[model samples]
Each structure stands twice: as structure tokens, then as C-alpha cells.
Target: MRRIGFLGCGKIGKALVRHIAEREDMAVEFIQDPGFINDIGVQCPVLAKADEAAFAGADLIVECATAQVLSENLELILAHCDLMMFSVTAFGDPDFERRAKALCGTYGRTIFIPHGAILGLDGIFDGGPVWRQVTVETVKSPSSLGRQDNRRSVVYEGPTREACVHFPRNVNVHAAVALAGIGFDRTISRIISDPEVSTNAHRISLSGDGISITLDISSYAAGAVTGAYTPYSACGSLDRALGNGAGLRFV
Candidate 1:
């Protein structure tokens, strides 16, 4: 993220500002957030939208916006530089994913998907071919899942592709899991809105003829949608993506 910029200035974006504030490199160049006003307590200027100058200087743009926002601005953003894509749920649509990949090629740009809140992506990518099935069950607070239910309930259950369409903001980890392992349609995703849970949790189960693995990860976050540890994860991902020579990197 050389002279980086941010597409959204929400919790994750603001937290990332603080995370990399002291770094000599990877300093914030511009922030594009419509609702953002008042001092952000950072040295960077806030823009409602980035123009040519802002995009020209920025080698990478970190998108903390919603899936819809990414889809809307995909071409314009890619035209300038690489993108650290957080709204990976946008790729749940097979056509959108294909178009995004094609655009990356056309513009000579890259898109890096950071390891968000969940863990074990490395294992999934490695074990995918031989594994017979992969399933992930994610449990989050009702509010986190954008629900107001008084009782715990299963909000979504089915293939990862459809789950992303239903819960674009919440079930991104499921999308990540699907992308890392099997394709979106092949991976099973279950999202439960549990009023009893205070944290966002994921229970991933993988099985094959000779190997079986179960992985669980949870995070008590500062915001409803993003996990507390995500800022650090993004920072690490930015470092990994920048260090790689060219094209996209999954970190």
C-alpha cells in the first residue's frame, strides 16, 4: 500500500488509520467516506470521493465499504491501482467475480483478499482438492447480523454463494472460506443469529477420505460488523500484498 488510500472510513478503516499511523510507510493519503465529518485525529485529508490526483499517487486502495459499493466502483478503482478487497462478498455472484478478474487483467491491476476475522484459510487452500466437503457455521449477535430477533435463530443456511447475496455485510468470512477452498457453490455456509452470543464466531469443518479438520475462531469486536482483530489483519495483508511483486495476493 504505497501512499495508500481508503474507500470507506468506518470502524475498520478508522482503526487501520491508527494501526498504521506511526509507520514510516503505508501512511494514509486520502479517505473517501460520505458521512465522515469532524476531525478524524489523523494527518490525512478526508474526501467524499477520490479524484485523479488522489488515485494517481495511491498504489493501493483499501476498501472497507459494502459489497454494493465495491461493485459500483470496481472499474474506476481498478483503473488506477491495486485494491485490497474487503467486500469480497461481492464475488459471490459468478458473473461479478469473472468480470472483476477480467478487469484486473485488462487494467493490469491486482486485488488482494485479506484473511479477515476467521482463521485456517491456509489449510483450506491446501486441502481443497482432496477434501470431499467443506462446511462453515458462523454465529454472531443479532445486531451484528443486522437482525433484531429476541431469540436465537438460524438466519441463513445453504451454499456460500446465496448466503453472500442474503447477508452481504455479515457473511464475508463465508465467502472467503469458499474462495480459499472449494468454489462458492460447492462450500456449505450457515449463518445463525444468536442473541446469546457476545462475539462473532465461526466453526469450520473440513472432511476428506483420509483427513478431517475442525476449526473454530471467535472475536469480540468494537463494531457490529467487523471483528476487533480485523485492523491488524488488514495491516498484515497490506504488507504481504505490497511485498509481492505483481498481480493479486491472498494474505
Candidate 2:
């Protein structure tokens, strides 16, 4: 069985922990969540810090933490073990991609990126020298947008690199698009807030040589109190990508 270490206990992390706990092929050996150390409360072995030492005996470290955690803990995670990151938006950082790749090379560890909320990625890399572009239109309720609550609004539209800076929370799709197609600067992204939409809707359009594809996904908030995306839905794509032996294509 594969021994897994989790770096967060948020919606996605908790879901992954439950999923792994039920699996015969994998075991969650350690969980790290500084904010909720007491809240997790004997669910599994918990760690206080996000560091290589904390993850030292695990086969794979899965990061379901926030973007900030990705930025801070990425190096430690990479140095200690194989890593699969769900916070794909962190790749949008100017030096993140370069540094991550370098660490992977230096430590001889694999870094996996799971396709969080983008689509048409399998078809994006079907051909040669593929010059691709992506545009994301996220329509979410004002409550989801936070602060802006009055009317439907276009929150942002620009290169993925710039968009990541403005909307870190929503950049996973953009980062996934950038990594799958070209790079962050080349990929386009847009965010919209619509009060009429009760669910978080993500629409992605990809155009390249001889092909233009689009995907529309509407994800409802899971728990009533938290109002976050369903962990199963976000992590489902990751499970598929990992289980199918597809290398970071969907991530």
C-alpha cells in the first residue's frame, strides 16, 4: 500500500483523507494542518509544520492546502518526497514553475499536478508545436466572490500570470490551462460574478491548430455552512488523472 501524507485538512484534504482511508491500496500516514490541529482531533496522525522533516517517511505528499501553503511548503514537500499538488494556481508565481522543476531535478522527486477545474487538456497536447490559448469565465454568486455583492461583474480578464496575482483563489483553472498549453503569460483568463447563478460555473475555451474546444462545468457548493466546492468533484479529476497513468496532462 502507498503511504500518503496530506498537507491540509480543508474540504479537499478531508475528502482525500476519507477517500484514502477507505482504500486498501493507500494509507494516510500523516496530516499537517496548523490552523486546525485541535479541530482535526485524533482523526489521523497530525503534524504542526509543513516541512520535509514532517513528511519524512511518506511515499507521496499530497498538497491540498491553500495557494499560500503551496508557495511556502513546495520546496520542503519536493525535497522530502514525491508530491502531487491540487493548488495548481501556485505555478503562476513568476519563479514557482522554474524553482519547482529545479527542485524536482535536484531531489530526483516527481511533482504531479492534478487537473483541478479545466477541461480539453487531453486534446490540447495531441499535436506538434501546439500554440494554444485558454479563456475562463467563472460565474459565481456574489457571496462566493466576497466583498463584491451587489451585481454581476467582470472581476478580471488578462494573462494567467497577471490573473493569478489578482485572483489567487480562482487561478487553479488558469494555471492548469497555462501548464497544459503554453505558459502563464500566453494563457488568458477571465472571472465573472453573477448573483443569478447559484452554483459556481466554469467555462473554458481552448483554441489551437485545427481545433477549438470548450467545456462548461457547473459545480454546486457542497456543505451549507462552508459554501465551498464539493471536494469529491475537485479531487475526482485528480484521482482519474493519477489512476490512469497520465502524466500531469490533466493537472
Candidate 3:
């Protein structure tokens, strides 16, 4: 059985942990959340400090918290166990990304990034070096766009680097697409705030090597910045990470 630790008790964390707990092959060992209380209702030890002792027996740590948390407790967490990261926007920093990869290499621990709130990553990944251009257009409600507007608006446009900075938590799907298909600077991202749109939508367009691909996915919005399908996406990623011992693998 896999012993899993959680780094947040918020919406995505709670949802992911709950799903993991329901699985017979996994055990929720510890949770680190400063604002956590009994109200979280998960049967696990909660820690205020993310120290080595806190994650002593944890085989894996899933971070559903802010990118700040990833940067803050990275070394200590990596020293203890492999990590499943939901806050992948933190990798927008070249130094942090390089350092994290180096640390994972040094410690022989894997860092997993889920394809959250999007689809068709496998096709993009399989396309490889042939990719000429990848563009992602994300549309959400005004509230999710962090704006109070009555009309539709184009909130942001540029590379993934600036997009992540402007909408850190909201543009994780963009970062995932960039990491999977093209480099951050090369991947163009456009964020739209549509007052009439009731769902979160993503349009991924790629062109290269005599192939033109476009994938559009829409999911009901959970909040201004979150889609209902995100939790399920995280779970799917987790299932892929924990492979069957003898079954055919499909990823």
C-alpha cells in the first residue's frame, strides 16, 4: 500500500485526499495545513510545521496548496518522500524548476504534475519536437477572472511566464500545457473573462509536422478560478502515478 501525505486541507486538497482515502491500496498518513481543524474530518495526523518528523513515514507527498508552499518546504519535503504537485505554476521560475529537478535527481524522488482542467496532453506529448506552435486560450467567468465586469473582456495575453505571474492559481492548466507541449516562453496563452460564460473552457491549438490539432474542453465552474473537473483530473493523475504491478499501462 502507498502511504500518502497531503500538504493542504483546502478545496482541492480535501477532494484529492478524500478520493485517495477511499482507495484500498492507499493510506493517508499525515496532513500539513496551518488552518486545519477537526472539521477537515480526515483520519490523519495534522502538522503545523512541515518538518522531517512530520513526514517521517510518508511515501509520497501531494501538494495542493499554493506555489509558495512548494517553494517554502521543497527541500524538506523532497528529503522525505516523492511529491505529487498540483501547484505547478511554481515551476515558472527557472531557478526553482532547475533546483527542484536537481533535488529530485539527487534524492531519486519523482515529482508528478497532473493535467488539471484540460485534455489531450498525451497527443501533445507524443507529438514531441515536431511542435511548431502551441496556443492555449482559457475563458472563465468574471469572478474567476478576479474582475467585476458586466461585459466580456480579454484579461491577459502573452507567454505562459507572464500569464502565470498574473493569474498564478488560475492558469495552472496553461502551465501544464506548456510543460507538456512547448517551453513556457514559446507557449502563447490568452485569458478571457466572459460574463455570459457559465463554465470554464480551454481551447488548445497546436500546429507542426503536417499536423494541426485543436482540443476544446469545458467544465462547470466551481469558483471564479476553479473548474469542477479539476479534482477528478488530480485523481486520474494519481492513478497513473500508482501503476498496477502486472497490468498493461495506458497513459
Candidate 4:
């Protein structure tokens, strides 16, 4: 059984905890959430600070927390165990990204970034150096975009790095797309606020050597800033990490 440690207990974290709790091959060792004082019904210890000593025994440390959580404990967490990152937008900072990658290499720990709220990643990744350009356009309601806009508007238009900074909570899909295809700088990210749209929609367009591909996915809202499909993606990523032997993996 894999002993898992949680770095956050928000929507995605809570969902992952519940999913892992039901599995026979995994156990939630400890959870680090500042607001969580009570058990919260999970059979695990909750800590205010996700220190290295607390997660020393964990087989994998899943970070469903913010980019700040990742930045603050980069060395400590990597020194402890492998990391499953949800806030992948943190890598937008070149310095931070380089440091984190170095730490993972030095510590012999893997950092896994899930395909959160997007599609066609396998194809995009496989497309390789041939990928000339990739663009991700995300449409969401104003409320979900974490702002108040009365009419349809383009909230942001720039590289994935800047987009992640402006809309960290909303545009992780862009970060995932950036990582899967061309890097943060070359990858374009556009965020639209449309009052007409009830569900969150993501469109990824890629132009490569011999192929031009586009994929559109719409996810119903579970929260103002989150979709119902995100938790399942996170769980699927975890399942692959845990492994089930010789089965064909789906990227």
C-alpha cells in the first residue's frame, strides 16, 4: 500500500482523500491544512504546517495546494518523497522551475503533473519537436474567472506564464497545456469571460510538422472556479502512479 501525504484539503484535496480512502492499495498518512482542526471525518492526522519531518514516512506527497505551498516547501518536500503537483502554474517562474527540477533530479524524486481539465495531451506530447505552436483558450463565467464582468470580455491574453500569474486559480488548464506541448513562453494563453456560458470550456489548438489538431472540452461547474471533472483527472493520475502492472498506460 502506498502511504500518501496531502498538502492541502480543499475541494480537490478532499475529493482525493475520499477516493484514496476507499482504495485498498493506498492509505492517507497525514494531511496538512491550516484551517482543519478537527478530523474532518478522514482517518488521518492533520497538521497546520506540512513540514518535511511530518511527511518523512510518506511514499508520495500529493500537492493539491497552491503554487505558494509548492514554492515554500520545494526543497523540503522533494527531499522527503515524490510529488504529485496540481498547482503546476508555479513552474511559470523559470528560476523556480529550474530549481524544482534540479531538486527532483538530485533527490531522485519524480514530480508528476496531472492532465487537469484538458484533453489531447498524449497527442500533443507525442507530436514532439514538430510542434511549431500551441494555443489554449479558456472560457468561463465571470464569477468563475474570479472577477465581476457584466459583459463578454477577454480577461487576459499573453504567454502562459503571465496568464498563470493573473488567473492562478482559474487557468491551470493552460499551464497543463503549456507543459504538455510547447513550453510556457511559446505557448499562448487566452482567458475569456462570457456571461452566456454556464460551463467552463477549454479549447486547445496545435500546429505541428504534419498535423494540426484541436480539442474542445466542456466541464460542468462543481464550484465557481472549479469543474466536476478535475477530481477524476487527479484520481486517474494517482492510479497510474500507483501502478497496476503490465496494463497499457494512457499517458
TM-score of each: 0.91, 0.85, 0.93, 0.94
Order candidates by TM-score, high to low. Answer: 4, 3, 1, 2
lDDT of 1: 0.83
Please list the residue runs of candidate 2 whose C-alpha ends up more than 4 Å from where it truly belongs after superposition. 37-42, 222-230, 233-251
Against the true structure, candidate 2 has what lDDT? 0.70
Task: Please list the residue runs of candidate 3 whose C-alpha ends up more than 4 Å from where it truly belongs after superposition.
Answer: 37-40, 244-249
Q: Which of the predicted structures, 1 or 3, would earn the higher lDDT when compared with the native? A: 3
Cα lDDT, all candidates? 0.83, 0.70, 0.84, 0.84
Which candidate, 1 or 3, has the higher TM-score?
Answer: 3
Model 3: residue 203 alpha-carbon error in angstroms: 0.4
Worst 10 residues of 4 by lDDT: 35-44
On TM-score, the leading prediction is 4
How much is 38 displaced in model 2, in angstroms? 7.7
Residue 205, model 4: lDDT of 89
lDDT by residue for model 1 (144-206), tens: 877898898988889999999889999888899899888799899998888887888889888
